[model samples]
Target: MSVEIVTARWIVTGAQDETTPVIHDDAALASRDGIVLAVGPAAEIKAAYPEATVTDYPHHLIMPGLVNSHHHIGLTPLQLGAPDYALELWFAARLSMRKLDPYLDTLYSAFEMISSGITTVQHIQGWATGDLDEVLGAARGVLGAYEAVGMRASYCYAVREQNRFVYEADEDFCARLPAEAGRVMAAHLARQKMSFADFMTLYDELKAGNRNPRARIQLAPANLHWMTDDGLLAIKEKSDAEGVPMHMHLLETAYQKEYARRRTGTTAVKHLEKLGLLGPQLTLGHGVWMTEEDIEICAGTGTCICHNCSSNFRLRSGVLPLMELQRRGMVVGMGIDEAGINDDRDMLQEMRMALTVHRGPGMDHSAVPTPTQVLRMASEHGALTTAFGAEIGRLDPGRRFDAVVLDYSSATWPYQDPDIAPLDALIHRAKTKDVHAVLVDGEVIYRDGQFTRINRESILAQIAEALAKPRDTSEQETHWLRAQVFGEVERFYDGYVPADTPRIPFQQGSSRV
Candidate 1:
């Protein structure tokens, strides 16, 4: 039977035309076979579909489900303590920690994301183990968690050869590595520097197993920094051959810029462009240290950038010239890099941080990103970044019926002027607690503070136990090594400064990314 949901005073579809026109008194939506059939006046739609199952959501605002352009569900349990050092040091500290149980971690993160109204996530896998069976086992566990929670995701087994150098340490450190870690890392290395054959095999396996054709899942080469010239090229070739998109961390920090210049005799973006790897299929993450030439290449190639505002600020990564990128016709999407950095996968908080931060002082305060723009970055543009733009993002007839319903009566007071615009309220004032319902492909996965399809309590308990099981960190030379790896990263910032730059870090006092 068809499902009919009605009684939304306003609907924000995330369409190109900003404003989502209000329906008379009550609006309604109808869906069948997990695809939207119609959205209009309740009376009209109700009369048209007499036999449809009806759900009333009086006075609520309905909108498209959020699309998180970049997320790492497998990293949620690692949201341990704050990293008060530089990028390299923080990465080292993260590497030292014991890996969490993949099933528990994935389920915990998915539940949190769903509760906050994220219907889709482009998940970049970051864990490492030695054997192929173990690595695939961990990945399969994550995929199972996503399926169990009824969430849509684009899963990418992140690959890199450059950063592996950092992980390759003395025998003592290697000996301390978790049992599962060795197995997973080995499996990944065997397939390292992904070839066309590897890509086809993985693609075939995924395509054949996914019974729900509407579920958007793709294999991606998740490269970070200047991994390898050959590996980068191979990633591009494989993605083109399989007709899937690829993603990577590009120019995330000034350190990467320096590293790229030293290694390839060019800027990071320039290096990728030189390799002929810049295109619409490529989704570059961070892009905080981009140059004007880099911006031009992105616009010309129609490549999208995942703007990770929270992680950038947390690690002292430079601010991304967002307005400049937008002005040049570059597509931008929002991301919470790892759960450990953001502390939570709340998109509303992520959106708020993006709008307020990144605007340097003395720049017109009014020039900051507006609420609507932030919402777009997390929803429509985010979907576009992952090459799933046509499948998800907006709420419209013929599109997948993915949506989130917020309770306006919450303590956060989502109700404002009727003329204030629903999208504005959603972005500027909404909180995670305000999210009362979430749907992916017309399936009600979360509602009334509980998950409809999964056992939230059991997953939470499993993750807590997994995190509590202490691994041997005795190999760690110092406690500060767990906290701040380089002693003092701020010292490096003393003498050197950017041209005409403000003294303050980008995220100084801003709550919004």
Candidate 2:
């Protein structure tokens, strides 16, 4: 077999625990046929395989390409004229956002990811309002972008059998409106209506027709309130039938916590546990408002959590008990939900946020997240949540050779202290601009500010051209209807979280200073 040697100043063979060893001092990784074969000192690797071709990054540090474990939408809601409101209120505001071409939209986010050391994304595709065939075509477009770009994607069509707009049933919420508005809202909901069976069909067709070697079909429950128990059961059946994993969004806000207590008279985790849904096969996304009991249940079931740190902050969703989850031996991954704090999908920035956000307001150092823990979240733990499984997260033998090289000059050239561990320095200082090259399957897909397969400029220009056009009739209609319903949606939630409900994350929904 043909062999390749990738050399760098340092090579961190992705961490799994606080004490996982890291390679240093001119380390090199050798691979054959896209699978890692060996990693060692540069000279030893080269001498052992003198005939192998070398791709050396003398000024860089190499590590596993990160996984963006939870994501949705290419365009940010802020860019679509929606303000950052609470999670529930943000739903109505999102209706005013403009529709986008699925192919170009997917490419936009894919570019952002590959350029910033992220090679895999859990793209939970949803919010389609059309016939089955039309939505299927959009799903194809999303997959097509990832395949063309050579980025690994664990894709799922989010299943929402109810509660498309609010926590209440779609019919119930629409029926409560004034007559004229009610008619309009019902018609709007009609276009999005699809049976649980139809969603399964969508999954079957997508899985059968998928041509992306770097992509796999998965399932998502959308959210606890969005799916009926029957709908969730159907998803479980489909998952078991297909042998695929499920990523679900649950307990993202204090309001959602209240909604769950109202529906099942128990915490969301206990309800799911009773339904036999919690397991290693499932990942809970957001999970910001999970209680200590919920965390314990997840730990017991070996269920995974994808913590969207920035989303929780931006939407005023309460923070998940991350410190507690770690202590419970739970597997947690980091995600850039919607967008990062600076309004982009940068996993490096995401890692920093996850590292620092959970540090309590005290002088204690033992419980705070270590650099090793954050790296695990972005790499190995993130892989657990995706269909890729143990295939592509680490730079280890028997795994695919996917890695990113970052120029160490930016973070360490100016006389930084030597005693700090390699990961600690990287976690605190690295930025997107420091990413020098990204390799997937031992093939360099990105290097020196350019993608190997896709043209960033051309794709972006096409997107700009599309959005520049004046609003179409359908688009204009959606904006108008959203304006009329915005106030009603706000009123519907007035005193929604009863005074008796226990608030673990925040005592109140939101209050201005």
Candidate 1 lDDT, 181-260, residue by residue in tens: 44433333343344445444555665567664435556555554525677778777777777888878878877666667
Maximum-lDDT candidate: 2
Q: What is the C-alpha local distance difference test score of each model?
A: 0.69, 0.87
Off by over 4 Å in 1: 1-3, 18-25, 74-78, 81-84, 165-204, 212-215, 224-226, 340-342, 358-366, 411-415, 472-513
Global CA lDDT computed for model 1: 0.69
* Ten contiguous residues minimizing lDDT sum, candidate 1: 165-174
Error of 2 at 461 (Å): 0.7
- Residues 265-331 of candidate 2: C-alpha lDDT, one tens digit per residue: 9989899999888999999998877877788899999999999999999999877778888888888
Task: Please report the TM-score between candidate 2 and the true structure.
Answer: 0.97
Kindly report which residue stretches of model 2 are placed more than 4 angstroms away from their true locations once superposed.
19-21, 504-513
